[model samples]
Target: MPDGYSRSSRRLSILQCVLFCALTGGLAASGIVYDYSRTQELARQRLEHTTDLIAQWIIGAFHASDYLLRDLSGLVDTEILQHPHPDPQAQRRLTERLIEKKDSLPHAFLVGAFDRNCIVTHTNAIVGFDASERSYCRALRDDPSAEVFVTPAYVNNLDRINVTQARRLESEMGDFRGMVAIGVDLDFFSAWLDRIDVGRAGSVTIVDSAGLLLARKPMLPEELGQRVVEPRFLEAFASEDEFSAIAGPSPIDGVVRLFGIRQVPDLPFVVVVGEASRELFSDWFWRAVVSTGMIVLLWLLSVLFLRNHLLLVRQRSQLVRVAHFDPLTGIFNRRHFEHLADLAFKHARRAAVPLSLLLLDLDHFKPINDQHGHATGDRALLAFVEASLSVLRETDLFSRWGGDEFVILIEGDEADARILAQRLRAAWARIELRNDQGAPLSLTASIGIAGTHPAVPGELDSLEKLLAQADAALYREKQANR
Candidate 1:
C-alpha cells in the first residue's frame, strides 16, 4: 500500500512538471513575439519619420532651385538673347550668384535658344564638355511643356562625378532653349542625412527625371547610374502622397528592412531608405540570457513564465504611440507634420509657385502660466491647437513647435495665407476662459508670416527667414497693444 502511494505521488509530480514546462515555453514566446511585433511597429514609424524629413528637405532644395531658375528667366531680356546667347562675362556673373546664394548647389548650366547646344556654367573647376549628350537633353528638347526641367542623377565624364541638381533653361521666345544643370556634391548631402537619427546602414538617394540613380548614402557605387527599385517606387511616386514603404531585404545591404520612400515631387526622384535597430521590450533582453543560464542548472520554470505573459501587445502600443503622434498635445507630431509638409511643398513647387510658413505665438501667455498654473496653461494650449486646426486647409500643416510657439505651413500663396491668418486671429479673440481663480480670462495671438518675393530668387526654402520677419512684426504689434 505504501509503494502504491509513492507511485501515485510521483505521477502527480511528473504531470505538474509537464504543465509548468509548457507554460514557461508559452511565456517566453510571448515576450519574444512582443519584442518582435513592437520592434516592427517602431521600424515602420521610424521609416515614416525619416521619409517625411528627407522629402521635405529635398522638396525645399528643389523649390529653391526652381525659384532661382524662374527668377533667372525673368532676368533674361531680348537684349541678352539678341546677342544670340550670354557672353562669357555675363555667364560668369550668373554662375557666381548661383554658387554664392546656393552653396549646396555648386553649378548651373543653361542651353539658350540662340545656341546650337546647351552651355554649362559651374562653380567647380571642371572645365569643358559644356553639354550633356545624354537622354535628359533629348527629353527636354522633345517636351515643349517641360518648362522647368530637372535631369536624372547622371555621372558626368568631364568631372568623373555625379550631378545631383540639374534643371532646364528656356529662351526669351520660350523655345525648348537649353538644359541648365547644377552640380551638387553628393558628399555634402550624404553627410547631412547621416546627422539624422536613422539607424546604421540607412540610405538617402536622389533619382533623376528618367528614374536613374544620382546620389545614394552608405555609397552604393555598384548601384550608381542603375535602376534599383522594381517600379513600386515609381507607382508610389505617381500619387500625391509624400510617403510610402516596402518590406523586403534591400538590394544594397541584404538586410530585412522596412524601406521607406518619399518622392521629391519637384523632381522625378524619390528618397529611398531603411532604418536600423530594434526596440527593447523591457531593457532586459540580455538579462534574460543570464537568467536562462541560471535556470538551466536549477531546472527552474522561468522560461514558461516569460513566454506566456510578455508578448506583442505592449511593444506594438509603445511603438505606435512614439511614431504616430505628438506626446504633448496628443496630436500628430513634428514627424508627421514634416510628412504632410513634404507633400504640400511638392504640389506648390510643381506649379512653379510660392508657399507660406506661418509662425504663431500666444501673446503674453507666459504670464498666464505664472498667474494661473501649469494645469491651466496646458488647457489653454490644447484649446489653442484645436481652434487653429479649424482654420487650416486639409493640405496645410499645423504643429506645436514646443512651448508657446506653433508653426503652420500653408499650401497657398502669401496673400491667401495672410487672409487665413487674419481669420484665425479673430477666432483667438472670440475664445473665453476661466483662470485658476475662476475669473474670466482672455488673450490674443501674434502671427508672423513669411512668403517668397515673387520677383526675387530664393536659395534656401526654409521658414527661418520668414519667421524672423514675422517675429519682428509681432514685436511691433505686441508693443502697439501695450
Candidate 2:
C-alpha cells in the first residue's frame, strides 16, 4: 500500500476506536441512570405498601376501641349516672362490667362512663376522675350530633401518652346524657411497629388529622403529642390524594427521608412510613461504584489493546516495505521486480502482444565513486533513478538489478522500447551531481534492449530467458562504449 493510504487507514482505525469507546461509555451511563430511577421507584412502591398496611392496622385498632365504647355505653344505667353521687351497689356493679369489657380489648388503657358534667361516673381504672377538660369530652358537648369522637394524643392522668375514642350517650328524648370513652395506649402500636423491619434509620409514625404525632417507632418522646410542622408532610396531608409519597428533611429529627403517607380511611389519622435517603439508596450506591469501575476498566483495556494492534500493523507495514523495495532508491528490488515481470510476460504471451526488456549499466560509475566518496556515488545513483522514473510510464517495471546496474520491463515491442531508452538516456544526461568540492559531475548509462513478439515465440519464452538476452546485449553495448 502507498504510505498515504496506510496513514489514512491508521487514522480511521483510531477514530473508530474512539467512537466505540464513547458509545460504550454512553450506554453505561444510561444503564446507571435507569438503575437509579428504578431503585427510587421500587422504594416508593415498598413504602406505599408498608404505609397501607400500617394504616389498616391503625383503622382496626380504632374500630376495636369504637366498638367497645359503644357496647359499654348501652350497658351503663342512665338513672345511676344522672345523680352527682349514685347508689353504691349499682355503681359497683357498673365498675365490674367496665373492667370486664376493658380486659377484652388488649390495647385499651381505660374504659369508663361519664355523666353530663363530664364527671367519671363508672370506671375500669381511677374513680371520680374528672374528664371535662379533655378534647373528646368538649367535642361531644359542642357537637351534640357527633356520635363518635377521636381526640389527639395527650398525656393521661397516668402520665402515659394516649388517644381517646368516645361514643356520645343520648337519652330517650334525644337530649345529651353523657359519653362512654376508651383510652388507647400509644405503646400498643409502638410495640408492634418495633417488630417491623424498617431500615437502620427508618421509622413508622401515626399522626392525627391535626398533625399531632400520636405514636412512633424509633420514638422521639419529646415529639409525641406535638404537632409535626414539616412542609412536605403538611402538603401531602392537605392534598386530595388519600395516599402519597414525598421526600424531604424531617422537621422533628432533621434526617432526610422518603415518606409514604396514607390517611387512615374514615379515621382522623394518617400513617407515615419513612425510609432514610441514605439507607434507601445504600445498595444502589455500591452497585453504581462497582459498575462504573468495571466500565472504566474495560474501556482502558480496549484502548490499550487497540494501541498494541495499531503498533503491530505499523511495524508489519514497515517490514513489507523493507522486503519489497530498494532501501537506497525507494524502487522495487530485483526479487520483487522479477516476480511482477514474470506475471506480465505470461499475460503478454497469452494475448499475442509484445513485451520488451531493457538492461542499463552506469558507465564510469567506479571512477566517480573512487574520486568523490561513496556518498556522492549514492547521490548519483538516486539522481539516475529519479531521472528514469520521470521518463517511464506507471505500467513499466523499473528496478535496481545490482550495483551500477538497473532493469526495466516495458509493455511494448523492441521499437517502443528503443524510444523509451533514448528518453531515459536524455533524462540521465540532464542530471547534475556535485562532489564535496562543489564540482559538477555528469552521469551516463549504456542501455541494451531485447524484446519478444507473439509472432516469434521461440525468441523469449520466459523471464529468465529474456533477462539473459538483455544481459548479453548490455555487455556488448558496454564493450563498444569502452
Candidate 3:
C-alpha cells in the first residue's frame, strides 16, 4: 500500500516468521541435549575428583601407621629387648614406646614372638604375638621374604577386632622372626569420614585384599569381616578404567548400590569403596526432566505471544497509515499535515527553539484540472508528492496539506533545509502527467519551508504562526513568477 511493492513481499515475510518459529523446536531440543551432556561430564569429573581426595587420604592414613611402626623398631631392638632373649626390663621399655605412639596412631598395640618359654599367660606379653597357632602368624613366621605381613580381619581370640596392618621382626637373613602386629581400630576412621560429608546415602568403605571390610561410615557392625568381592562383585567392580558402576542388589544388604572403587597401592590389602544409592540418580534426573518441561512450555508461550504481537503491530501500522494518509497520494492528508505541524511546534517549545513552517502550493494546478481533466490533476498531485519526498531526509517531514498544496517541516540544519527546498523546486519543474482526455500537463510547485533555527529561542507562539510566515513567502514567490 505504501511504495507500490508486489504481493510476493508480504507473503515472504509471513512465511519467514513461520519458518523461524518452527526452528525453535529444534533449538529447544538442542538445549536439552546440551544440558544433559554437561550434567554427565560434570558428574564424571566430580566423581573422579572425590575418588582422588579419598584415595590420598587413605594412603596418608596407611603411611601414618608405618611411621608409628618405625619408632617401635628403634625401641624394641635398641632400648628394650636384651638381644636374642626376652627380659622384664625389655617388656617395660616396649610398653613405654607403644604408649607414646598410642595418641598419634589409631592402631597402638604390640605383638611379639610367642616362644614356648614366653607363651605363659602373664610373664611378658609381646605386642605382635597374640596367637602363634593362627595362619596369620604362620604367614609371618614361615614366609622368609615376608618381612611385613598385614593380616586379613579374623575372629580374634581377643574380642574379634579387625587389623589393617602388621609388621614382622626377622633377622637380616630374611628369617621368619616373631611378628609385631597392631589391630588398627576402625573407630579412628569415624572422625575423618564424618568430616568429609559425601551425602546421606554416600559412604566410604575400605576393605583388605582378602575382601574383609576394614572401615566404613554408617558402618554395619554385623558386616565387619564380611567379604565385598562376590558372585555379584563384577557388577560393582565394572572395569579397571571404570572407577564406578551401579552394582546389582546385594544378596547380603538387599539394596542396590552404585559403587566407586579406588585401588590403594600403599596399603597391601586395601580397596577404597565409595557407595551410593540408585535412588540418588532418579532424584536428580527427575529434576532435570521437570525443568526441561517447564522451559519448553515457556518457549511455546513466548512464540505465541510474539506472533500475536507482530500481527498487532502490522494492524496498528495499517490503521494509522489509512487514518492519516490520502488514498490517491501516499502522503499525509490535510488533517495529519496539521497534526505533524502541531507536533513540531510542541517539540520546539519544549526544546526552547525558534519555529519555521513551509507550505507549498503548485502554480497553475486547477488550470490543468480544467484544460486536460481532473485525472491529469490527480496524476500531477501524485507526481508532486513523489518529487517532494525524493528530496526529503528522515529528519524532514513531508505531507500533502490539501488539493495541490503540500507542507514540509525541517529541523536542526538550516543549510540542509535550503538545499532540500532548492532540490524540490527543480524536481517539480521536471514533473509531467497526462489528463483523462490525453492532453499533456507540465508543473512547478510554489515552495515553502518551516522549522526552528538553533540560534533564536522561543520566538513563535504557535506552529500556525510559522505556517503563516511560510504562506506569505509562498504568495510572494508565486506572484513574482506570474
Candidate 4:
C-alpha cells in the first residue's frame, strides 16, 4: 500500500524473473550438449559394426583363396616341373588340372605353378610369364620356412591391380621349389563395396599390413598401391585391438570423418570404414537449433507475463491509495476516517475506555479566498494539515472532513483531547503561508471537543450524537472568542 512496499515488490519480481530465465537457459544448454554426445556415441557404434562386417567378408574371401592355393600346390610335382625341357605330355596334364582348379574358385583370376627359377612352368592362362621379381615368388625361393605368403597390391601384366596369395612348393626331400599362386582381382572388393551404402561422403578402404592401399570404394585411382601415411591410420594399424574407432581428417580429401578400423583375421590386411561427420550429425544440428529457439521463446514469454503482473499490482496499489487518502494533503479522507472512527468507538465501548473527537474549522477561510484568491486559501489548508500532523501522535486518526475543515479521533477522554487540541493550535499558528503576490498570510482554526465517558450513561451513544455535541461546543467557543 505504501510506495516503498510497492517498489520492493517490483524489485523482488524482477529478481525472480532473472533467476528463472537463467535456470531455464542453463538447462537447455546442458540438454543440447548431452544430445550431441549421444549422437556421436551412436555413430561410433554404427561404424564399428560396419567395419566388422567388411572384415568378415574379406576374411572369407582370403580363406577361400588360401584353400585353393594350398590344394593346387599339393597336385603339382615341383621336381618334375623344375626340369628345363620336361615331357610335353606331363606339362599338358598339369595345365589342364590348373585350369580345372582355377575355374572352381570364383575370385581367383590366374592360377599357376612356378619352378625353382621363379619361372612359370604350367598355367591356367598364358604361359612363359616370369615371376622372378614378384615378392611372393622371391619369398618362397629365398626362405624354405615360408609356407604361405600374401603379397601387397601391384599392377599386373594386364594393367589391373591384383593381390596374390601363394603356398610354397617343396620336393619330397624338403627342398624349396618355388610356389603355386593365385591372383585376386582388387575389383572384386570394389564391386561388392559399391553395392553397400556408407552415406554421401563416406568411404571403405582395404590396406595391406605394410600400409599399402589395396582397394577403396568411392575410389581414387591415383591412391591405389600407394602407402597410407596418416598418423591415425598408422596408430590403428599398430594397435592390438582387433577393431577400433578413431576420428580425423582424411589425408586424401581433407574431409573430417569418424573411422572404424579392423584387421582381417589371419591375413595381412586391414579394413577401414569412414562416415562423414557433417552427414552423420545433420539431424542433431537442426534439433539443437529448434530446441534453443523454443527455450528462448518460453523465457521471453515468462518475462513478459511477469512484467505485466507487476504493472497490474502497481496500478491496484495506486487505486487503493486514491480511494482511501486525500490527494492534496496525503492523509486519510472523510469516508475512511468515518470507518476507522466506528471501529474505534466499538472497541472503546467494549473495553470501557474513553474515546474523544476533535473537529477543526479554519476561521475566516472564505474572506481569505475572496481577498487573495482560492490558490492562497488552498495553500493555507495544506500548511495547516502539515502543522497538525507534526503535533498529532501516530495513534491518532486525522482526516480532511471538508474544504477548510478537518477532524481527528483520539483514544483518550475530552481532557486529554483538549491537550492535543491546544498543541495543534500552537503548531498551526507558527505556519508561514503566502499568496501568489508574495504577500504574507495568517491562518487560524477553531476546535470542538466531544467524547464518550465510561462513567456517563448514553451521553454519546453514536458517532452522530458525538459530532452534534462537538459542533455546538465549537460555536460557543467561536462566540466567546469574538
Top candidate (TM-score):
2
In the range 381-462, model 4's lDDT, one tens digit per residue, is: 8899999999898889999998878888888889999999889889988999988888888888999999886435866867
Best-first order by lDDT:
2, 4, 1, 3
* Model 1 poorest ten-residue lDDT run: 107-116
Worst 10 residues of 4 by lDDT: 77-86
Per-residue lDDT tens digits for candidate 2, residues 144-191, read 779999876777888877778888888887777888988877675675
TM-score of each: 0.45, 0.76, 0.47, 0.74
Candidate 4, residue 4: CA error in Å?
4.5
Across 346-404, the per-residue lDDT of candidate 3 in tens digits comes to 77767865544567888888788887778767878888888778777766667777777
Per lDDT, the best of the predicted structures is 2
| TM-score, candidate number 3 | 0.47
**Residue pairs that clash (backbone atoms under 3 angstroms), model 4:** none
Model 4: what TM-score? 0.74
Better of 2 and 4 by lDDT: 2
Model 3 whole-model lDDT (C-alpha atoms):
0.61
TM-score of candidate 1 to 2 decimals: 0.45
| Candidate 2 regions with alpha-carbon error over 4 angstroms | 2-42, 77-162, 168-179, 183-189, 239-243, 246-251, 349-354, 390-395, 413-432, 450-461, 469-482
Residue 125 accuracy (lDDT) in model 1: 44
